[model samples]
Target: MEVFKQHCQIAEEYHEVKKEIALLEERKKELLAKFEQAEKEKLDAAQLAREYEALAEENRTLKLAQSQCIEQLEKLRIQYQKRQGSS
Candidate 1:
């Protein structure tokens, strides 16, 4: 009877350990998924940073072009004034 009780106790311990292992495995899977999601977000943020840099460069070029146009307009106005003064 003692031997039978020992066997039953071992079986119960075995089942509890098995259940604990299953729960740990599930937790590990959930953690892995979260890690993957974080990595994806990191990649997306890097891509967005690159795109923003490109936009800033484009804006700089546009501003330079606008300045050049203003300079040309000023030169034309000066020439027109010189003509009127001569006439």
Candidate 2:
């Protein structure tokens, strides 16, 4: 009878250890999924930053071109006025 009791106790402990292992494996999978998601977000943010910088540079170039055109137009207007006054 004592041997039988000992066998039952061992079996119970074995089952408990198996349950603990299963729980630990499930937690590990959850952590891995979160890590992968964070990496993806980081890459996306970097891409957006690069695109924004390109757009800002284009905006600056366009503004400079516009200023030069306006200056040229003003010079042409002044020349026209001088010719009219001489006539």
Candidate 3:
């Protein structure tokens, strides 16, 4: 009877260890998936930053061109007014 009780206890302990191992394996898989997702997001963020920088440079160029055009138009308007006043 003593040996039988010992055998049953050992079996129960074995089953508990297996259950714990299975739970740990599931948690490890979940963590790995999260790590992969984080890496993908990092890559996407870097790409967006590059695109934003390109667009910002283009906007600066356009603003400079617009300022130049306005300066030229102002000069033309002043010349026309002077001509009209002289005539």
Candidate 4:
């Protein structure tokens, strides 16, 4: 009778261990998915940062060109005014 009880106890322990292993496996899968999502977001953020830097450089170049054009326009206006005044 003791041997039968021991066998029963071992079987019960084995079932509990299996259940715990299954739960752990499911948790591992969830954590892996979260890690993959974080990695993708990191890559996307890096790409956006690069694009922002490129756009900022383009904006600076455009502003510099605009300033030069405005200066040229002012010079031309002054010359035109002088010629008209002489006439």
lDDT of 2 by residue, 1-87 (tens): 999999999999999999999999999999999999999999999999999999999999999999999999999999999999999
Q: What's each prediction's TM-score?
A: 0.82, 0.77, 0.71, 0.83
Each model's backbone clash number: 0, 0, 0, 0
Per-residue lDDT of 1-87 in model 3, one digit per residue for the tens? 999999999999999999999999999999999999999999999999999999999999999999999999999999999999999
The Cα error of candidate 2 at residue 85, in Å, is 3.8
Deviation of model 1 at 75, angstroms: 1.1
Clashes of 3: 0
Q: Could you tell me the TM-score of candidate 3?
A: 0.71
Please give the TM-score that candidate 1 achieves against the real structure: 0.82
Please list the Cα RMSD from the true structure of every candidate, rounded to 1 decimal place. Answer: 1.7, 2.1, 2.6, 1.7
Query: What C-alpha lDDT do the candidate models reach, one value each?
Result: 1.00, 0.97, 1.00, 1.00
Q: Best by TM-score, which number?
A: 4
Q: Clashing pairs in model 3?
A: none
- Candidate 1, 1-87: lDDT as tens digits: 999999999999999999999999999999999999999999999999999999999999999999999999999999999999999
